[model samples]
Target: MSRLLHAELTKFRTVRGLVLGTVATAALIVGLGLFVAANSVSVCSKGTVDVECPTPPAGPGGESVRDKFYFVHKPLPGDGTITVRVTSMTGIITYPPPNHDTIVPGLVPWAKAGIIAKRGTTEGSGYVALMTTAEHGVRLQHDFVHDVAGLPGAVSTGAPRWLRLTRVGGTLTGEESADGVTWTRVGTATLTGPVEIGLFVTSPSDLTVHNGVGGGTAQARLSTTTATFDNLGLTGAVPGGGWLRDDVGADPEPDGPVHHPGSAEESAGVWTVSGNGDIAPLAGEGPGTQMTLLGLVIGLIVVIVVAVQFITAELRLGLVGVTALTAPGRARILLAKAAVLGAAMFAAGTAAAAFVVPVAERVLHANGSRRPFLPVPDVVTLSLTVGLLTAGVALLALGLGALVRRSLPAAGLAVAVVVLPYLAAVVGGLPAGASQWLLRVTPAAAFAVQQTEPAYAHVIANYVPMAGYFPLPAWGGLAVLAGYATLTLVLAGVRLRRADL
Candidate 1:
């Protein structure tokens, strides 16, 4: 078996066309990665001057995050409890379609008005909140990405919601209530240190989703929310100071004021806070690792050709019968061929992905793109996933070659099953649901392995194929491709052993 494997490897390296095709796969990945990175540019006007857009802040878990809101807070030198009753939540949405000329009172479903205990006033600081959203009822959110559902109802003047956040040592507990007396523990988070505990309000941009061809499209309009909080209460080692207001993470406008600045007002112990932005994982709207790996589709096509040739070329030359006599077990021969091709493809794909990931990120950053902060380990994981994806596709193609016993048809079938579905999902103008369905059941599902940003139910964004969110998790999607490959290879093995060459 080892000798057979070695023979297959030797044959693989000896074929100039096969060797060149393998190299071309890597070349295409890197080439397209560089192209996309170099072309990406982001600029914003600060007053009359155009400058590069600021990068999003990294959260405690190291993911890029949007953490901006209006806070009416005071320093809590020790563990403390802050409570507030959100009497009303309202918002303004500017220029939403059709007429595109109106500033109207509304709330983008996720708009939040809450009480929070935060490590500091900085963007992306560790925090916990018991918040009432416009449509999602009460929620306990912590560390920018974690969200726990509490009471399920909208907040209004008539039906006010009471929120409480308490810090006990490193643990923060969130609770919610309707009448401010019967509190239900909403959730908890662990974040130690002195914090800013206060009343806060925020609203993310209103998104108008369009069910367009090739997945859904969305447009974001500037929006802000105002929440009226009465019956504010504080307990536990509170310092003597007035409430301070800040628009955390707001970008500076060109007119010298903070862009979309949030404001807070207090009158007769009641506070009205208005703010724009979100405290959530920034996804779908930025240049990500997926963009750098976009070349994989083209690379996969090259791999299909090479992988198919690995098996079908021998059959085409009528050399399989001679090889079968040497190996004796035809299935073993097929296994040897697959092992050699899969390994080579894995090595090439991994190396290309590893090179392109960091290099393309730097290129994108240099070109002023909104580059998300991905940890080194996560980057390595992505590269490896790409490698595995490449290997899976190659194996699938090799099996198809064996099954079809022809080159063109096998390569075409591999692409039809893998690459074409991916194109339809990402570029074919398929509806978002149809695109997600295509990605889930097809070998194209493996592309999910490259998605760096995860779709969060809490974050309001276009979570679709074109936006790089997959219905399946990374390894799960790869496993789907692997399952297809394994089944195809099993059928191919049986054919090889039973059929007369």
Candidate 2:
């Protein structure tokens, strides 16, 4: 078997197109990765400018940007209400583009700052809030996902925005007032567990961009909202004199004033409120991988062409029968063919990723974007994923060549089975709903292994089906591809051994 494998490897290495194709695949991977990195740019919340420097968003489970803020509260494990008046709400929406972080003066119209009745300080918890927007007036939001609009105009210090939240078992109600009396119902929400009722203030701390790959992002720079709760009021299960203060998911900058976002002036009738965090989602409208899809699609095409030609050329010249006899076992010849193709593809893919992932962050940085870093271990895992995806597809193609013994039919079937579904799901280039089930059942599931940013129920990223995002996890998706290759290769071996063609 070793000698047979060696012979197959020798044949593949001697083929100039196969060797050149490997080089071309590597070139495309690195070249395209560099292209995306070079073209992309980012603005930091602080004054830092780097190319796509992904602000390691504080959401622990990647649900929403629920980290970095202040929470002053008393535990109300059951039904409760917390009411307060918001005097004046103001903030700075900063845009620190690649070169410099420019503070944008004041909050945008939709910027929210107000009172919250949360499930807890931990991210992804169920909760609701009655907040004042910069322009849209009062709003009600729940679970970091649901948003309901209220009174449609900015409230002033003189108008006096009165906010209230009342909990009834699983249901919570939000209300707003003008003169600390006539409270108007804003909206309501439902939470299933223990609740934390408190005075909370938060800001956008990150950008929510959508135009394109490097669109103009108006990221939040700073938000220091100072509101006085004069006619102090807490109804139902109020625990006085023991209020816990937390930074939520963020703490004060090491050198900033006020620890835990202004937590030093909580007197009998005073609470200086400020928050530097985003209760929002990350924008993943485009590809986040370091050009893997760009490289994989083209590489698969080139390798498929080479693989089909490699086997069919032998069939055309009547070398298949001769090689079967020479190799002693007909299945051995098929195995050697697959071994050769798989090995070559694996080498090509690994080489490409080695060059692509290492310098990815640096490339983005050179281009003045916030670059996300991948550790060496992660880089190696990603490299292995690339290699495995290429190798599995190669073996599948080789099996198709053996099954059909014709170049075009083998190539077409191989691509339709392994690559077409991927393109369909990724770009909707094919018919609608065609790729969903195809990816689920076909070898194209392997593409899921390349997915870095997964869709979250709470995070509102562009979880578009046409965006090439597969619904399977990395290894699970790769297993589907491997299963197809193994089954086809086994059938190909049996056909070669028993059928005289």
Candidate 3:
């Protein structure tokens, strides 16, 4: 077996064209990665002058987040509790779908109105809120990423919801009640020091989805929500001043009003609060590791061709027969060939991915791409993922070559099953569901392992393949591709044992 392996390695080395092809493939990976970074430019303007966009704030978990809402708050020096009964929630969707001409009274699913005990009035501060959502019922959210579901219903005048948030030392507890009598603890968060306790309201942009040439498109229109809160109660040490109103994250307009402004008012022991924008983890597209790894798609095609030809070249030259006679164990010979090819591709792929990722990231930032709010995969993880992906594709190609006993057909089959499906899902005109289906079932699913952005149910956006989301988890998708490769190799082994050489 060792001799057979050595002999196969020798054959691979002696072929100058094949060796050069591998080198060229690695070069292509790096070249295309840098090219993508170079071309990805984000430009912002203020009036007629160009301006650099401000970096987004980091949440408690260091993930990028959107923290904008209307707060009617008072400073509490220490431990405190704030409670409010939310009687009604209403919103307007501007220029919705179909005609896109008029604003309608409605609410986007994530519209939230609640009582919060935050570290301060600052955006992105650690806070916990027991809130009622437009569609998701009662929820307990903290720090941006963490969310827990509470009761299951919307708020109305007849069916009001009671929300309470309390802080004792470092622990914060959230509770909700339908009748303000029996309180159900929703969740807890850890935050200490002085905080601002208040009533707050916020709504995300109204998304209008449309099917288009490339899967679909989502247009975000400005939207706002108003919440009517009565029976407001507070506990613990508080300042003597009246409630302060601040529209966190809202920019001042030319006319001095808040841009996409939020409002706060008190009348006869009742508070009406209205706000625009979201107070959650940032969703949708951002600069991702995928930007650096774009070259892998083209590089994978080059690898498929090289891997297919590795075996097919031997078959074409009538050398496989001579080698089979010497080895006697046909399956062992095929396995040995696969091991050699897979190892070589793995090394090249890992090196290329590792080198390009950081380099491309610097380039991307220089070109004004937004810093990724999602967790970026580390260099080692990215390298190993790409390495494993390359090895899997190479083995599959080799198996197909062995089964078909021809070069072009086997290479074509490998690319059709893997590369085409990937390209189609990411860039083709297929519907979002169809794109997700392809990524789930096809060998192209392995590409999901490269994905850095994950879908969050709490943050609604286009979770489509084109928007850098996959239906399957990263390793799960890789397993799908690995399963196909393993099965194909098994069949090829069976064929090699029975077929005429």
Candidate 4:
């Protein structure tokens, strides 16, 4: 066994394709890794530019609030109650767009009508102008909004204006007040979970808020608009339970304090708030660090092709008969080839993973995404998995070669079995479960290890038919592929024992 294994290893080392494939795999992994690392460093250094940058709010633990100075004409939704306090009295806060044909054009789909406050208006409009039921959608029926009494009129700019949102049961209560201490209820409304709350500003008539360029032109047509916000807050019935706050101040010098009327404020749009609910755990970093274990399977297939060539090329030259006569044990020769192929595959897989895993992690991190660093356990599992897959493909190739005793036919059969199922899965749109199962039975399934995401899991659960469901858990998927390889090897071993050299 030792002598046979040594001879097989010696033959494998001499193969040109095997040597070249190893070199190419290493180069690809390293080059990609460096690129990803450089990008990640650039992303991290951008500081304030990162959307996910941590910015804690001022004051102690209190209601988290986001302030947007300039809001476009769009509705805002919330899981709880919401209030809209207008600081500017000159802008038009209308329910129906000026035109009936087009809904607020360019608005995000999630936008919903809430409250509108115009400037320079009194009696019907004041410090707080409430959005009527006709304006708000059906979801806000249970929620309430209130207009404050003795509210001020519109002005160029001075102090900030504020609105408060408080959720009770399944209802929201909106309140407005001249000062944060005294408040009046607006109206009530309801909203869905993980609700979104934010402000929007639109041009009463294409007026720029900063320079006040268009304000004079649309002055006669402009409605009452008020602007002054301070002490913005949010709260719920539960004690010490609400979304966290992160306060962002006015954009500093250089650019100056220029405000666009119909544009979302840099500090406002789409703020993620954690209310009285659980935050989902971040996904495990390691498993998603690199390509799936399946990538190694492809490398194994290449090794197996080489193994098949090693075996059948000799057979085509009538060397197998010569080898068998000298060795006298066909089983030993078959075992030697299998051992050689498995070792080559294991080495190649380890090297490829060493190169690929780090690069993958860098790419994810550069994008402000987290992933696991390659660890010893993952390496071991991947190496074992690749070894098993390659051995199976190699054994099958050897058996086919022995049966056909011709290099071309055996090579073609090996490639077909290893490559055809993957092509079918891609082109046929087979259900993931069926595809995975078919892949498990074929050499292609070994590539499943390369998947870090729940690609197959999502496919099986969401797309596959109920009766066809055969979803394998991540580790289980690897096992299933490994099992196929083992089975092929066992069958090939049996064939080798019986076939004539």
RMSD list, candidates in order: 1.8, 9.6, 1.8, 16.0
- C-alpha RMSD (angstroms) for model 1: 1.8
Top model by TM-score, which number?
3
> Which 10-residue window in model 4 sums to the lowest lDDT?
272-281
lDDT of 4 by residue, 1-501 (tens): 777787778776887875675555445444555554545532222323444432322111121212222322222232333444433322332333355343232221112222332211111111122321111211211211222222333222353234555654445556655545677565544433333343322222211111121111111122212223323333322224333221112233234542222222223422211111000111111234333222443454455456567677776676655667767677678777767766665565566665556555656565665333445566556545544555555566666666566777777877787656655553345545556576566656554544433322101112121111223443565565556555655666666677664
C-alpha lDDT score of every prediction, in listed order: 0.87, 0.69, 0.85, 0.42
lDDT of 3 by residue, 39-81 (tens): 9887876555577766787787777789999988998878888
lDDT of 1: 0.87
Candidate 3 at 37: error in angstroms?
A: 1.2
Residue 228, model 3: lDDT of: 99
Mark the regions of model 3 whose C-alpha exceeds 4 Å error after superposition: 47-49, 254-256, 373-377
Q: How close is candidate 4 to the true structure, as a TM-score?
A: 0.46
TM-score of each: 0.95, 0.60, 0.96, 0.46
Ranking by lDDT: 1, 3, 2, 4
> How does model 1 score by TM-score?
0.95
**lDDT per residue (tens digit) for residues 210-268 in model 2:** 32222222233344444445554677876667678877765434356444354425666
Could you tell which candidate, 2 or 3, scores higher by lDDT?
3
* Better candidate number, 3 or 4, judged by lDDT: 3
